[model samples]
Target: MGVVAAERIKLTSTRSPWWCAALVIVLGLGIGILMAVLSNDTEATQGTDPFILSATTATGGVSGFGVMIVMIMAALTVTTEYRFGVIRTTFQAIPNRAKVISVKAAVVAVVAAVVVAIAAFGAFFLAKGIAGSGPTIRMGLDEATWRVLYGVVLYAALAAVLAVAVGALLRQTAAAIALVVLWPLVIEQLFLLFGDIGKDIYVWLPFANINHFLSAHGSTTADFHWGPWGGLVYFVVFTAIVFAISLGLVNKRDA
Candidate 1:
């Protein structure tokens, strides 16, 4: 508990976490507002899909910026210590490198969850207002909408963990962040850039797999099904592989 508190203090003392979080909220709201204002006349028909539209509407803003901020926050959290040559002291103070990692991951998970939920809520309501009262999208109403919201929050936290994982593996913020962000934008996008026939490929990428599966709106592709957990095992497997790599590097590398 004490160690967690101390680690939390380090995060709070720095401007990066708060600032990055704020940026996420702003970007989410901005995109939501844009979509809402542009399609204010869109009406939800009785037979129409409300969750689908709402999910696509709000997440369009977070798709790019949120990933970038997650990488930045994760990189800064670990690399900032390296930059200050304070990692050695951090190691000495904590003595349990794994626990330190856990604390860092926890801080990220909690903060990301809260901030993302807020962003989702804000975006939903903003879009609701601008969407002109035909129907309002609220959180926790249906399985699909709530599932996507939960997944978004989880994705944000996972991005943070990914940041820390990459940071531990590489030990440089620049390289870590580049690898994290670039992999999705350049490498992963290459999978779906072909379009139409890329459904199988789209269902396999890291973010794509999770977001595409959870997204009721078909943001990534109009093909993925929101029914049944297609490959929950696959998600667990990938997360485990990445996490193991992080643990290995952190244990072997010199502080």
Candidate 2:
């Protein structure tokens, strides 16, 4: 309880987390409006088929860039502590290095989950409201729609845990942030450039699986051995392995 409280205080006392939160909100709502406006325009010009807005399209910014920003904030939480030598103090107070790291990850993960959930739903409703009365807009709280909405929150929380682990391992803001941001946005996409082999390998990649889990029907072309739930489990297991490795290294290395 004490460690958790301390971690929360450390997270909120900083201005960067607040700024990141605001940016996520802006990205969520801003992109929602953009998608809604575009859908409206597409419908206006279309002759036969109308443009249908799925849950996936509506929350694109929240799940994509918003989640990335959360990961950056999560990485900064640990790297910034190391930067100012606060982590050493924290270690002295907790003694159990693993406990401290675990608590930090939990705190940040929870906060990220909550923030992204709000952003996800906000984006969905805002987009629906803007797109207004149409056979094109299909933003219902159906099973699939619910999955996409909450799946984003789940992914954000897990991604935050991964970011915290990366930060603890690297203990450098720039490197950790760059790796987390680029691995998903750039590096993951680059795998597709390798042609058939890349496509095969892409099915097993962590973020690719995440995309599969969040995607609407026929939205993703990757041929996976399992279903969306299985893809999520694969990502969960991968994150656990990385986090476990970081825990081992953190205890073995100096603060």
Question: Whose lDDT is greatest here?
Answer: 2
Kindly report which residue stretches of model 2 are placed more than 4 angstroms away from their true locations once superposed: 43-51
lDDT of 2: 0.90
Evaluate all candidate structures by whole-model CA lDDT and list the values in order.
0.71, 0.90
Sliding window of 10 residues with minimal summed lDDT for model 2? 42-51
Model 1 TM-score (2 dp):
0.84
Q: Per-residue lDDT of 166-245 in model 1, one digit per residue for the tens?
A: 78778887888788878877887777668777656776766666656456544435454543255334554676688778
* Model 1 root mean square deviation, Cα atoms: 3.9
* N/CA/C clash count, model 2: 0
Q: Looking at model 1, which ten-residue stretch has the lowest summed lDDT?
A: 44-53
RMSD of each: 3.9, 1.7
TM-score of 2: 0.95
Cα lDDT tens digits for candidate 2, 1-255: 999999999899889999999999899989988888878885453778666687898999999999999999999999998999998999998899999999999999999999999899999999988888666677877888988999999999999999999999899999999999999999988989998898899888999998899986633566787888888999999999999999999999988
Candidate with the greatest TM-score versus the true structure: 2
